[model samples]
Target: MNRRHFLQLLATLGVAGCWGSYKAYATTSSAKARVLIIGGGAAGLSMAARLNSVLETPDITLIDPSNEQFYQPGFTMIAGGIYSPDEVKKPQSACIPSGVKWVKEKVVSIDPVTSKVKASDGNTYVYDFLVLTPGLQMNFDQVEGISRSTLGVGNAHCMYDYQGAQNTWKALQEFSQKGGAGVFTNTFTKLKCGGAPKKITMLTDDYCRRNKTRDKISVTYYNASKDLFDTPYYAGRLEEIFKERDLNICPQHRLTGVDTASKKV
Candidate 1:
């Protein structure tokens, strides 16, 4: 059965109780197992699903802060105006298997030796096995002259967040309307979903073309790396696209600061 139908049947029969008993037996037997998974993102959820499908019954607890789960790959499409935010977002409850315990809270600290984790809500979770899939945190504040609060507000926009993706769409639309040179920069640091920056840039270019502002607006992409993409094959293709569109690509150029008032980078 599909996931939705399985969830409906589980809910109708209150199968969560049966799973609780299974969890107890697994934890108590000589072969008992208790798995605690952290982050509940792509990796964590996929692991849980695989384990659940193989085992007759599984003891799994997944910890995540947000009830809303996002397909991060879709963020690139969202920035490109190819998909809506809602299309990329799914309720965490839907992805979580019924048999697994889902904790909605942030992990504050981890005691690896004891195999215990402490959450922001003061709950202590212990397990026989621990799987950590917490993703890297972005430090936008590290960008000089850019404050954490200024993101998605003023001349700054990043697709790291859903709102940030919408902000980028808005910024591109406004720039198209005003008609000016727009500089899009990606830092030297390894960013999640590396194609995201160029995706936005291309989308902006497409928008300008559609609005008949292509000549008035100049698009430049600056990156510390020498290539458009990490992979040679993809970089070659991207270079061709950039050349065809007359989009300027500046390699080995890193963004130091943004002068929002002067509208220069």
Candidate 2:
């Protein structure tokens, strides 16, 4: 069944718990609890907002080292030339909800037994409740011959970071004009947005098509799993679309390293 029909079925069975069906029941609490939240990203900030709405006198303190907040989902669109770098970031101070304390410090260590957290500023914070929402980290060192500094150096670009996204946009423009082979890959491990690799690959294909250079450009997609998408409903359709678009799909292959000197992976 299609997604819409499946969701309809869920609603009929009274199990539809989608975001659209969610209703917030805001009620202020009298407890003056000190809540310490680690990280200032979307998850942390959103949680703080919810708590602030539900607590009459919220004592929420958010700790993060970054001075700027990034809209990470926009990175892929930025690489696709749809969003500029400036549009994806804003000062972290502007994102922190009012009535919430912002601690501009990196968390060094957490001592759960003592209910305290040691920050980089050589200060310890005590909290009645702790919320950890620290985001994921990208380890370029794990991949041999490719480091963060080497991105965009040899047509090697990624959309996971701000600079990398801009570099990818630059490389894509050159590639679209030069009309060469383009390869897209994904890791075997779970990603924050696992469909990003496929999305960017399709975006490149679309971009080349719009530029009227698709025929000269060969597109190959390497996936580390057995299927392009784990969901059978969409996987079958995606494979069909890839075939129709002349996009090569190779499954069960993981990219371990890159040989930028010889243009090999």
Candidate 3:
């Protein structure tokens, strides 16, 4: 079943866990299973929660260095000025489900042969079951002439991180107020969300239109692939939207080099 349908069924059945699923435990031996989870992101937290709810006696340890856990999907909303920074920000302690131990540290290295992981604090963790849900990494250094130092300096902005999204919102507001050419492009690297840039671009255009400055400013979108979307059905609709909105679309224009001095990508 689809996720929506599954969730509806869960709600209907009144399942006991957060998403509507109950737990069943039988009294037997005092045996317990050791579960070691890497990364405290969404996937890892979900796995930990589910296992904690189901397992009779589970020793679950979740490892991550960050104290603040962010809801990254809401970043686009922040960039679009639909949400504030506080809305997407949350304490990591709030997401840890029942019976899961939180280790506030980074993992230095992992040894699969010995089923052990070394933490930054010079401690080793040995596990019986390992779940690795480390999220994807952003390679800001991959772009030429642009380092972490130059972000949010000028009209240029990025929504990949929390501060970047807030800065992007400000930059977009400034650009929307002042008439100028607004250019946005995507990278060829595997990103967390492929449509995030496009969504922000469309939102910016809409914002400009609402402010009555859209006619003075030009918006252009550059994509790494030739197609707007992988599926033909959605691609055709997106192309139609581009035509209707008079938005410029440049296909197969991946970002290779950047002139950070001029704020050109």
| Cα error of candidate 3 at position 205, Å | 0.5
Candidates sorted by TM-score, descending order?
2, 3, 1
Report the Cα lDDT for residue 158, model 1: 84
Q: For residues 93-188, what per-residue lDDT tens digits would candidate 2 score against the true structure?
A: 999999999999999999999989999999999987787899888887677778988877678788888888888988888899998889899887
Q: Distance from true position, residue 100, model 2, in Å?
A: 0.4
Q: Pick the candidate with the highest TM-score.
A: 2
What TM-score would you give candidate 1 relative to the actual structure?
A: 0.84
What lDDT score goes with residue 142 in model 2? 77
Candidate 1 lDDT, tens digit per residue, 10-65? 33333323443333323211123677889898978876775565345578899998
- Among these predicted structures, which one has the highest lDDT? 2
Question: Quick one: RMSD of model 2?
Answer: 7.1
